[model samples]
Every structure is written in C-alpha cells, then in structure tokens.
Target: MELSEYCALDATALRELIRTGQVNAAEVETAARQAIESVNGDLNALTQPLFQSALDHDPDGPIGGVPFLVKDSGPFARGVTFTLGSRSIRGAVAAVDHELMTRFRAAGLATLGQTTAPELGLSYATESLRYGRTRNPWALERGVGGSSGGAAALVAAGAVPLAHGNDGGGSVRIPASACGLVGLKVSRGRTPSGPLAGEAGFGLIAEFGLTRSIRDTALLLECVSGPAVGEKYTLSSPDVRYTEVLRADPGRLRVAVTTDAWSGVPVDLQVAGVAAEAARTLEWIGHSVSPATPGIQPDDIVEGSMLAAVATGAALLRAPVRPDPGRLEAVSRALLAETLAFTALDVMAALDAQNRLTRAVGTFFTEYDLLVTPTLAQLPARHGELDYDDPGYSMRDWLRRIYQYGPFTAAFNVSGNPAISLPLGQSREGLPIGVQLVAATGREDLLLQVAAQLEQAQPWAGRQPSVFAG
Candidate 1:
C-alpha cells in the first residue's frame, strides 16, 4: 500500500482493509513508519518510535492491525518506557498494562510509538526542554495543544490513525482543536486509569484518544468504554452502542451555547463567532438553541484544577526516588513549590469547589440537553507563546494563563461531563477552530448523535494539514 493511501484512511477503514486482506497489516505498518519518518523530525511528535515492536505485534480484535500511538502522559502499558516528557526523570518501564491499554490491545490497535506530553502532563503546549517543540502539522510555526500535543500532531499529520490522550484540563481537546482532529473526553470512569491508580489527576482527567472522524470516536468509545475491575467508579453502560447512536436521530431539543469563558476572560472574537455559527448549525438541524452560560464559577474551574494539579505534582516529587526541582521547567518547579505550602484545608476547599462547580453544571442540564462552546478561547498559538519555562509566573498565574487561552474545556473535566471537540470551523488564515459539544455525565450517546449531525453539516474530512503524509 502507498503511504498516501494509508494516510487517507481512518482507523475503521484500515481495520476493514487489513481484515479483508485488501491490504496486509505489515504493509500498513510500513506506510505508517515511512509517514512517521518523513514528518516526525519536522514535528518532533514521537519521543520513541517502536517500529520493531509494531512489526512483531500480531493484533486481533475489532480494530486489529491499525497503527496507534500512546501518550507519554500516563495509564501505563507493560514494557513501554516513558519519561513523562520531563528532563529530570530517568526513563522507566511499566510493569503491567494499565486497564486502558488492556482495552486498546483487546480492540486490536497496534501500539507503534509514544508521543510527547508536557512535563507531568501539566502544560497545554507540548513544547518541552527534552522533547523540544512539537510543531502543528497545519501551521509549522504554531503549537499543537499540550500534553496531548504530540499525539495531535502525529494524528493530524496522518502518521497514525489515532493516538491516546488524557485530559485533566483540556490536554486532549485543546490540542485536537489546534490540530483539527476529533477529541472526545469521555465521562469520568467511562475509561479506566488503572492497575496503577483508581483515578488520574484526582478524577479531573479522562483518558481517551484523538481521531480523524466522529465515527471513529463512536466506535472507539464502544470498544473502550466501561469500568475496569476494582475501579472506584462503575458507570452503567449506555443503553445502546455508540456507533448505532450516530445513525439515530438526536431528537430536536433544547441546546445552550456560550461564547463567554467561565473564567470571565475575553474569548477571541473569531473563535466566539465560530462557536455562535456552530450553535446556529445546531438550530438549523432542528434543535432549539439559545445563548446561555452554564452558571459555573471561575473558582469551579481554577480551584478544582489547581488542587488536582498540585496533588499530582506533589506525589511525583515526593516519591522515594524524588524528582529534583532544579531540573524541572520554571512552571513545573512553581507547581512543586506550591505543593509544599499546600495544606489539608486547601484540599477541603478544592473539593468544596469541585462539588459546587459540578453541581452548577449538573443543574444547567435541567434546562438544556447539551452545551456548545469554542473548544479554545483562541487559535493554535505560535511557538513559545505559552512559555512553560518562564519563571515569572506562579502556579496560579500559570493556570490563569492557560485558562485564558482555553477557558471552556476545564470545567467539564471538573464536572465529569462527556465533551467532544470538533473541527467545525477554520480561520481565513487556515488554522482550525474547535467547536466543543458537552453532554451530561454518561450521555456520550447524545454527544455522538449530535456530533454525527454536525460532522455532516460542517464536514472537515477533506481538509489536510500542510505537513501531511499525503
């Protein structure tokens, strides 16, 4: 198979091709390798490419034999080595597959490589001292959104059909927006975090992957959604399969759309306009749409996220083999310092805020079936625009900076809502603007149905990044 042909197909199509013997798995793997080789140096998306391991992997399952990349960020896979995109940590190998990896394997995704994430998965920009900057495939000078940045870059560039990503505070969605891919952050507990921990980022993070199409997102959720054994959360499965929901009509219902950032920061006008247009698309599709905010407070996003982030950093820095703060980037070191002064009462406050924030969002659903907003406040930033290494910012200041750029996505992380960011609009300059659709907890079926409609209304499949394999 040609690299261009391989790059053109989504994971579902590739799976069908491999299964039907139209193209052998080995050939697809080779095309993927060549695609990676051609663009990875320019993009710096791969921290480690396991081409030989991929060759040896005899995948079998629903998506068997399709190329996939795991984020360096977490939910470990056995035998895979990771540095978590930090310079201070020595490389370590996982002893067992995290439950998510187990599901990925069971679904037949051939894990070919690891993508770069921000240090401790904190920043939105994938640029790090170790991995360097992971340039956007769409615009070489710009960033591909953080932590999941490299994954977005590779997948958008067509190096792989899909790649794992986790969102504690927009790590997946922001990058998906910046890179023009389908980023779905499943409801908390919809996917497992582990044999390692019950929850990642204190239940603020949801593990999933970035994809090219809504159907891919639907099928993937069907394959990976469900609780792992011994999980703290055991959400009941959806009444129907997610893929089936794509064809089902999402009944005309109340829809709420907001251009305002929860943080009360200014959203770029272009982005807000795109979000407004997306709401109009929803209205055109027969849903009742209105301008509305979820009534969630800024503290709901900032405090809830701050506590989760500080705690995560504290655990890593306090481990037996402690990570040296001197080796960390300016922002991560600031986070570590904040962890020291952190107190139990602070934890209580954060938890309280989480309760209030989640309650506020939950209450909004009483009036609306879904909410639409710009996935980011602005477009994909230029390199170094989100300076992770700048010592001028404190932990709170850093959070504020990130929240300014992407104020919409973090709230759902705190609220445990299922949110999907779609590349529904593009800039005149050609950058992708992500329009996010959020549904109440365990309502992914609703999200997918509407997403399917939006995908049809504003199709993005023909759009390709400048740095594509094709």
Candidate 2:
C-alpha cells in the first residue's frame, strides 16, 4: 500500500488487513516511513524514528502491523533516544523498554517513532526552546498543545492512526483538543508508569494516548492499562473489553454540563458554545444533559495545588535524566527556581489539599456519572503565547498562567479520575474545540460508553485537517 493509503486506515482497520494477509508488517513500516517523510516537515512531530527496531521484531496481537508513535517523554523505550523536549537530555538512549512499550509490542502495534513533547512536559504547549515548536496540523500559525503535541499532530495529519500521549496536566488532552483527536487521561495507576520511574507529577497524573478515533483509544487502553510490578496503585479492569462497551448502547444517564471554572475564570464563548453543542448531541442520542457544578468547595484548591506543584517542579531540576544544561527554555528554569524556593512544609500542605480536593470530587460523582465541560478555557494558543521569558515574574504569576489555561484538568489528576478530551466541535476561527468527559475513579467503563455514543453521533473520524485531506 502507499504511504497515504496506510495513513488513512485506523489501527483496527490496519490490523484487519494484516490478519487477512492483505498487508504485512514490513509493508506497514515502509508506509509509515514514507508518510513521516511526506508530512513531518510541516509538523515536526517525530523526535526519534524506530523503523529498524520495529522491523527486526513484529509481534502479533490486537494492533499487529499497525504503525504508531510514542510521546518522547514518560517511561523509557529501549535503544531509542528520549529527549522529553529538552536540549539538556539530547542524545540520551533508553537502556530498556518501559512496560507499556512491552504491551504495545504484545498488541502487535509497530512503534515506528517517538513524537514531540514540551520540554520536560513542563508546560501545556509543544513549543520548546530546544526543539523549536510543533505546529498544529490545522493551522501552522497556532501551536499543537504540549507535551503530547507531536502525537496529536501525527494522528491528526493521518501519518499514523494512534500515538502515545501522557497527561500530567492536560498534556495529552490539550494537544488532542488543539489538533482535533481523542485524548484520554487514564486514572492514575490505571496505566503503568514504570520500568524507569514509578510516578510522575507526584502521582497527580497518568499516561495514555491521543488517538484519531475513540475505538483506537479504547484498544490502546486495553493494551496498556494494567498496573506493572512495584506499582503502588492499580485499578480493576472491566469484565468485558472496553470495545465491547462501544458496541453496546450507552443508555440514558445523568450528564452535567458546566461552563464555569473553579477559579471563577469564564470559559471562552466559542469553547462554551462547543460544549453546549455536545450537550445537544447527547440529548439527541437519548442521554440527559443539565447544568451542573462540581460539588467540591472552591476555597483555594487551585491555588493550593499550584503551590504544591511548584515544589514538585523544583524537584525535577535535580532529576536523574541526562542533564542538558542550556537545553531547556527559560520558562522551565524559572518555574523550577520558583519551586525550589518553597519549604518542604509547603509540599506537604499541598498533598493534604490534594486529598481534600479528591474527597470533594468523589462526593460529586455519587450524583453524576459524568461531567462535561470545555477541555480548555481558551482555544489553542499561538506559538510562545504562554512564554515566561520575563525575568520579573514571580512563581505565583507563573502558576496563575498555568492554571488559567488549564484549571479543570489538574483537579482530575489530584482526584485520580479518568477524563477524556473529545474533538467534537470546531471554533468559528477553525480551531478545534475539545469537550471533556470525566468519570469517577476506576470507572473508565462508563466513560468509554459515553465516548462511543458521542463519537458515533458526531463522527470526528471522517473530519481531517486540510493538509491530510488532500
């Protein structure tokens, strides 16, 4: 098959082709290389190519012969270099495959390359002083959201059907929304973060993928969703496959739509309108939608978490990854310095606050099965729009910038719930607008159910960016 023809098929379809003997793993890999050569000049998404490794060993499973990519950050890929979007760690190679990569191999998905991430995935956009920037497939003028920006871009451009993405604070979903794909942030510990380090963002986050289709997302989750050895936490898998849930109808359930941010920031009108449109679609599909507010108390949760995150961010300055002095951007360095200024007591206080916030969200889910809201308060940001180049800014100001752009996502990290950003609508300006679907802790089944229904109703798979459509 031609490169464009291979890129056009979803992972499932590709697998079917391979199983039916119509295509082979070598052909799929060739197609991926050709696709990358054709599309990556405009996107700058792939950080390291693994075509040789994939060709050397092709396993058989659910996604066998399907080409894919992993985010440059999080865990380790054996023999492949992982820069994590920083110049500091350039040329570093993984000594062993992370457990999730092991699962990807078992599933028969060929990981032909690594995708771009923000420097250390510290911020929400994929622009890095180290690697330049990852441009959105929809518009070169705008950024693809970081730190999974590369994965989102490749999937959006049809270079590959699914790619690895991990969300600490909306990294996966942010890029997914910005580039128009399905990004799922699995419940913390629901997906293993091991074979190198145990947890990241102090267990406030989890890893998964940004996929062009919900079924691809579901299949990827199945392949890599269980806990690995030495993990402190693990969630029970559903009795039936998540793809099975997609095949069944998502019966009427209570759905809540909220446009208000916990920090009192107003959602952009276009984003809110997109969420409303999704709500109407749910109603048309036999689900109930009503205005709902989170049950959590709003007294300093966002601020407190930001302060705590500062301490965690500070710890990364001394991280074991190959240090790329002068490789990271000034914003990351400034943020790290700010985190270092905090006392150990401050971090403890933040963890306590995180517990309280978790309890509050847990209480809310008792009444509502899902919460629907704008994935981002604003549309995709311009390149360097959230840059912290000003030396005069305080850590508090930096935190404000981060929180203002990503208020709703971090809360779910603390709560350790599964939430997804679905590219259900587009802004009048032609930017993608992702609507969030959040589920209770360990209840990904319900979340997938809702996603499958919405996916069918709106059908984002057929919608492609102009670059790829041609």
Candidate 3:
C-alpha cells in the first residue's frame, strides 16, 4: 500500500484490512516511517521512531496492524528515547514499558515512533529546547499546546490517526483544543498506570490519547481503562461501552455555560464565540444551556495547585544529570526555584485548595449535569508567547498567566472528573476552537453521550488540515 493510503485509514479500518490480509503490519510500519520522514522535518514533532519493533510485531491484530505514535514527555515504551523536551536528558531511554503502553500493544497497536512534548510536560505550548518547536499543522507559525502537543500535531497533520497523550493540567485537552481533535482526559484512576510507574503528579492526573474521530477515542479508552492489579484506586465502569453511550441518547442535560474563565478572567472574543456556538448547538439538540458560573476562587487555588505542579517540576530538575540550572530556560528555571519556597505545609495547603475547589465544582454539577466552557480563554498563542524569554516576571506571574488561560481544565482534574474537548468550531483566523464538556466525576459515559450528540449536530470529522487533506 502507498504511504498516503496507509496514513489515511483510521485505526479500525486498518485493523479490518489486516484481518482480511489486504495489508500486513510491516507495510503499515513502512508507511508510518515514510510519513514521518517526509513531514517530521517541518514539524519537529517526533522524538524517537521505532520502525523495527513494529515490523517484528503481529500484522493481523486488533489495532489491525495500524502504526501508533506516543508522546515523548512521559515514560512509556521501554528502551525508547524519552526526553521530556529538556536538553538535560537529551537521549534518556526508558528502562521498561509503562503499563498503559503495554495495554496499547496488547490491543494490537504497532508502535512506530514517539512524538515531541514541552519540557517535562510543564508548558502549554510545545516549543522545547531539545527539539526546537513542534509547529501546528494548520498554521506553522502557531504552536501546538504542549505535553501532548506533538501527538496532537501529528494526528492533525495526518501523520497518524491516533497518538497517546496524558493530562496533568490540560496537556491532552490543550493540544486537542488547539489542533481540533477529540482529546478526552479520562477520570483519574480510570486507566491502569503501573509497572514502570504509578500515579502521576500526586494522583492529580493520568494519561490517554488524542484522535480525529470520537469513535476512535472511545474505543481506545475502552481498551485502556479499568483498574490494574494493585492499583491504589479505580473508577466504576458502565455496563455498556462508551462507544455505545455515544450513540445512545444523552437525555436532557442541564449544561452550564461560562464564557469567562472560572477566575472571572474575560475570554478572548473569538474564544467566547466558539463556546457560545457550542452552547447554541446543544440547544439545537434539545439540551438546556444557560450562562452560569461554577463557584471557584481561582487565585487561592491556583497558587496551591501550582505549587504541587512546580514541586513535580523541581523534582525533575533534581533528577540525576540536572539541567545546567543556567542552561534551563529562564521561565522553567524560575518555576523550579519558586517550588523550593514551598514547605510541606504549603503542599498540604495546595492539596486542601484542590479538594475545596473540587468540592465547590461538584456542587455545581449537582445542580447541572454538565459545564461547558472554552477549552482555553484564547486561541493558540503564537510561538514563544509563554516562553521564559521575559525573566523579569516572577514564577508566580508566569504561572498565573497560564492559570488564567487554562482555568477550566484544572478544576476537573482536581475533582477527578471526566472532560472532553470537541472541535466543533473555528476562529476567524481558521484556527480550530474547541469547546469543553465536563461531567461529574466518573460520568464519562454521559459526557460522551453529549459529545456524540454535538458531533452529529456539527460534524467536524472530515475537517482536516491542508497537510492531512492528501
């Protein structure tokens, strides 16, 4: 098969082809390699390409011999290069396969490569010191949001149909929103993470993937979710598959819409317009939508959660072969330095704020089944907008800018609730604008139900970027 044809098929279609012996896993692997070689130069989204392992794997398998790519920010495929976009650990290879990745392979996904990420998955935009910048597929000058930014860019560019992503603080959703893909941050503990690691950033987050199709995302989650042996916590699974839930009627949902950030920060006009359109789309589908704010003290909580996140960042700096504290970008180094100011009590305080904010949002969900908001307060910022170039601002100011821009997503993570970013609208600049649909903790089924309805209302599945149009 031609690389173009192989790159075009979604995971299910590829698997069907494999099962029918129309194509072999090796051919798919070659196609993925060729695609990466052809486009990665312009994008800089790939960190490691594992073509040989894919050739050695099964062809007529579940992922149907489809080639898959993973984010380089996290520890996943064993013995693979994992540089979380830092110059410090330029060629660090993981000692073993992370548990979630094992599940990916078991489900018949052939691992052909790894994608780029922001440094330590810390930034929202994916301009890393190690690999330079991962450019957006739609518009090269704009950034793909980080952590999962490269994965999102690759999927958006048609380099791959689905790629792994993990959300600690909107990492998955941020890129998905920016790139116009279906990015689901599954409820915490919904998927097993083990062997190589257990629980990320103090159980504040977990990892998953980004896909062009809701069905592909739903099926990927179905394959990945469920408690692993010896897991500290697990969520209750629905009796039916999430894909089925997508087709199922969501019933009448009371969805609360807020154009403003939870902290009362005004949203960019285009961002708000996209979110309002999504609300209108919900109304078109018989759902009740209204302007209502979820109660959150954005400042108080942002400080605390940020401490936790920066503390995680600090730990990475203190990891063996620490980046030349000087070599580290000014912004990231400042963040790590600020984390040093936190005491154990400070971490506890952050945890307390997280719990309180989670509870406050939970109360809103008690009255409203869903909360809808712009995935970000603004469209994807130009490259270097969030970079550490301005060393004058303290770390807190830098973090506040990020918080104000991304207030909606972190709350769901703190609450351990499920949220999905649907690419239902676009900015005037032709950039994709995503609307977030959040459900109560463990209510992913219902969230998918609403998303599926939205998908049908304004079908965006075929809206590929120019690169992917081939």
Candidate 4:
C-alpha cells in the first residue's frame, strides 16, 4: 500500500487490510515509518523509535501489524527506556512489561516507539528540557497539551492511528483536545495499575489513549480493560462490549452544560462559545441540555491535587536513584521540597478532601446523565506559555495558572468518572477546540454512545493538520 493510503486508515481498517491479505504487516510498518520520517522532525512527537521490535508483530492477532506508540512516562514495555521526560531518570529502562503493555502486545499492536512527555508529567504543555518541545501538528508555534502531547501530535499528524496516554490531570484529554483527537479517561478502576504501583496519583490517574476514531477508542478500551492479577481494585464489566454499545441507542440524555471556570478566571469567549454550540447540538439531537454545574470550589481542587501530587513526589524520591535537585526541573524540585514538608496529617487531610469532592461531584450526576464543558479554558497556549524554569515561579502561582488552563478536566480525574474530549469545533485561527462530555463513574458506555453520535453528526476525520503525513 502507498504511504498516503496507509496513513489514511485507522487501526481497525489497517488490521482488516492485513487480515484480508490486501496489505502485509511489513508493508504497514514500512508505511508508518515513512509517515513518521515525513513529519516527526518538525513535530518531535516520537521520542524513541522501536521499528525493529515493531517488525516482529503477529499478523494473526486482532490489530496485528498496526503501528502504535506508547507514551514514555508510563504503561511501560520491557527493555524500552521509560524516561518521564526528565533528566533525573534519563537512563531508566523497564525490566518487565506493565500489564497494560502486555495486553497491548497480546492484542496484536506493533509497539514501534515512545512519545515525549513533560518533566515528571507535571505540566499541561509538553515543553520538557530533556526532550525539548513537542510541537502541535495543527500549529507548530502553539503547544500540544501534555503530558500526552507527543502522543496526540503523532496521532493527529497521521504518523499512527492511535497512541497510548494516561491522564492524571488532563494529560490525555488536554492534548487530544489540542490536537483534535478522541481522548477518554476511564473510571479509576476501569483499567489495571499493577506490578509497579497500586494506583497512580492516589487513584486520580486513569490509563487510556488518544485516537482519531471513536471505534478505535472503544476497541482499545475493550482490549485493555479489566484488572490484572493482584490488582487492588476491579470494576464490574460493561453490560456489552464498548464497540457493541456504540450501535445501541443512547436514548434521551439529560446533559448539563457549564462554561463556569472552576478557578473563577474567565474562559476565553471563543472556547466557551464552541462548547455552548455543542450543547445546542446535543439538544437538537433530542437530549435535554441545560446550564448547570457542580459547585466545586477552585481552592479545594488545588489543595486536593497538591496533596496527591506531593505524596506521589515523595514516593518517587524513595526510588533507587534518589532524584538530584540540580537534575530536576525547577517546578519539580519546588514540588518535591514542598512535599517533603507535608506532614502525615496533611496527607490524610488531602485524601479526605478528595473523597468529599468526589461525592460532591457524584451528586450532580444523579440529576444529569452527562455534563458538557469546554475541554480547555482557552485555545492551545504558545510553546513556552507555562514556563517551569522561570526564576520567580512559585508552586502556588503555578497551580493557579494550571487551574486556569484546565479548569474543567481535573475534577473528573478526582471524581474517577469517565470523561472524554471530542474535537467538535475550531478556533478562528484554525486550531481545534474540543468539548468535553463526562458521564458518571462506570458509564463509559454512555459516554462513547454520545461521542459516536457527535462524530457521525459532524465528522472530524477529513480535517487534517497543517503538518500531516499525507
């Protein structure tokens, strides 16, 4: 197959071609490599290339021969360098495949590369000193939101159909929104987190990926869902496969729309406007839409996140290498220093607050089937917008800035509800603007149904980034 033809197909389509012998696995891998070679230099998306490893993929497996990229931070594969986009742990290599990685392999995905992430996955923008900036395929000067920035950039630029991404605080969704892809953050226990740590970010982190198609998202979730052995938490299986659920009717959903920035900072008018239009579209499609939101205080979110992050930082410092302050980014070092000062009581307080907030947000869902909001508060920021290396940067100020950029996303991570970012609109400057759809915990089926409906109503596949592989 031609490289352009290969770049145009999603994982499922590519897998079908291989299954039917229309194209061989090696041909698909070569096409993917050509696509990456065509655009990765300017985009800096793939941080580590595993082309030889990918060549050995099973042609008989479900998505066998589909070229895939795993994020560098987590969801590790054995023998691959798992740098969290930081100089502190530059040479760390994974000794064993994490359960998710094992499952990805079992599902027939050809893991060919690792994508860049922010330092310690701390920032929303992917501008790490270790790997430099990961530029957005849509607009190179703008940031591709992180820490899944590189993954999103690669997928959007057509280097791959889908790529692995984990969301702690909007890592997956933020970049998906920025790069115009489908990003879903499943419920806390919907996917596994074993053999490394019990739960990431005190259960605030959820593992998933960014994809160009809703079916690809559903296919991947089906492939990777369920608990690994000795898991601390496990969720009840969906009534039907996510792919099957897509064909079923969602019925009339009671969706509440909110443009209220949780931080009290004003949302950009264009961003809010697009989200409002999404709500209108939902209403037009027979779902009830209203302007209502959970009363979540910005300070509460900041405090809870800080506590979880500090605890995570403390745990990282206990690792064998023991991070050096000079090697760490300024923001990371400051966060570590602050975490070191946190007392046990302080940690407990944060956990308690997170629990309360989760229950509080859960209450809103009792009245509404889903909540709609702008995935981000503003358009994609410039590459250096969130300067972690600024001499005057303070943790408090930095947190405030983060809340401003991502006011709508972190709450769902804290609540452990299923949230997805869909590229439904565009900014005047031609950047993709994503709208978020959030369902109650364990309701990813409903989320996907609604998202697929939107995808069909206004297809986003034809829209290509300026720096595209084709």
TM-score of each prediction: 0.98, 0.93, 0.94, 0.97
Candidate numbers sorted by lDDT from highest down? 1, 4, 3, 2
**What TM-score would candidate 1 get against the native?**
0.98
lDDT of the structure predicted as candidate 1 = 0.88
Please give, for residues 155-175, the per-residue lDDT of candidate 2 as tens digits.
898888888877777778888
lDDT of candidate 1 over 1-470, digit per residue (tens): 99889999999899999989999887988898888889998899988755476622337788888999898964377887778888887767777887888888889888888899888888888889988999999999999988799999999999998999999988899999999999999999899877778777788888999999999999888999997788886687878888888999989979999898877788888898899998998899999999888888886688899866886787787666888788899988888888988899998888999999999999999889999999999989999888999999998888889898899999999889999999998988999999999988999999999999999998999999999986
* Of 2 and 4, the candidate ranking higher by lDDT: 4
Compare the candidates by lDDT and give the number of the best one. 1
Off by over 4 Å in 4: 55-58
Q: Ten consecutive residues with minimal summed lDDT in candidate 4?
A: 50-59
Report model 4's TM-score to 2 decimal places. Answer: 0.97
For lDDT, candidate 1 versus 3, the one ahead is: 1
lDDT of 1 at 280: 93
Model 2, runs deviating above 4 Å: 48-58, 296-327
Of the two candidates 2 and 3, the one with more favorable lDDT, higher being better, is 3
lDDT of 4: 0.86
Off by over 4 Å in 3: 55-61, 317-321
